[model samples]
Target: MSNAEMILELVRKNNGVVTAAEVTQAGISRGSLNHLVNSGLLEHASRDVYQLAEVWDNEMYQLQIRYKKGIFSGKTALFLNDLTDRTPIRFHMTFPLKYNIGVLKKQNVKCNRTKP
Candidate 1:
């Protein structure tokens, strides 16, 4: 199969989402991601994540992809883990004690830090 085909296959396997890091790990070049985006087959979802153009924007998934170090917590975790039926008004995430939270706060995420 062609490079584009391989990339599309990867996206399909990933529930219509894929990341540049994943592509590189699969031995694919980032150019394939750009090509797919240019062709309108995929849309940039975040800094390094892409999704099928037709897929609805999953905010939680996108945030998780964008901040790999941020772990869902509190009400957000309850909703994500199916422990609650109500959606959280704000996303809650926890990062390491020393991790920078400026960017996460800019995204409107409720940032929490682990105890050192």
Candidate 2:
């Protein structure tokens, strides 16, 4: 397959989303991403993130794609692990101590100091 075709296939595999890293790792030129965006085939979801034009913005997707190191913890974990019936109103995220958590804090997400 051609470069654009390869890129599109990758996007499809990622549920209509793909990152520059994934693109490069797939042996496709990262620069080709701009071509796709300029030609209206894809749109920017975030820095270095792209998604199909028809795909709606997904919050969970954005979280997972943007923050690969972030983990769901605290009340969210309890609910997920079936330890509590109450739904978690907040998502406790644990990342490296040096990781900038300003963005998460801005969203009202609590940051854990250490990993479990």
Candidate 3:
């Protein structure tokens, strides 16, 4: 499949958001992404992340992508494990204490980075 088509397929399979690293590894260039955005095919939803314009279920995708750098935890982990009936208004994740960079501190999400 073509690069654009492959990118779209990955977005669809992953819900919506696809990592910039993944796109780069797939041989897609920044110019190509800009072209897609200009064509209204993709939208930049966060730093180093893009989502398909036609996809609607983006919350899960965003959560999963955010958790990609850490482990799902607290209410978020409970939700991920299907132990909760309510959806969290904020995302929660945990990483190694040494890797703690407070990336999600300002966002609605909660992050805990402690020694595992």
Which one is best on lDDT?
1
lDDT, candidates in the order shown: 0.90, 0.84, 0.75
lDDT of 2 by residue, 61-111 (tens): 577677888887788778779999997676777887777888888875778
Instruction: List clashing residue pairs in candidate 2.
Output: none
Task: Assess every candidate by TM-score.
Answer: 0.89, 0.75, 0.77
lDDT tens digits by residue: candidate 1, 1-116 = 88889989999999999999999998999999999999999999888999999999898988888777889999998997899999899999999999989887778689999975
Per-residue lDDT tens digits for candidate 3, residues 4-108, read: 888888778876778778888878876666777788999977777788887664665665675566767799879878999989888777778887556568777
Summing lDDT over every window of 10 consecutive residues in candidate 3, give the lowest-scoring window.
Answer: 57-66
Candidate 1 regions exceeding 4 Å error are none
How well does model 3 score by local distance difference test? Answer: 0.75
Kindly report which residue pairs in candidate 1 clash with one another: none
**By descending TM-score, how would the candidates be arranged?**
1, 3, 2
The candidate, 1 or 3, that scores higher on lDDT is 1
lDDT of 1 at 53: 94
> How close to the true structure is residue 76 of candidate 2, measured as C-alpha lDDT?
72
Task: Report lDDT (Cα) of residue 63, candidate 2.
Answer: 75
Q: Is candidate 1 or 2 superior in lDDT?
A: 1
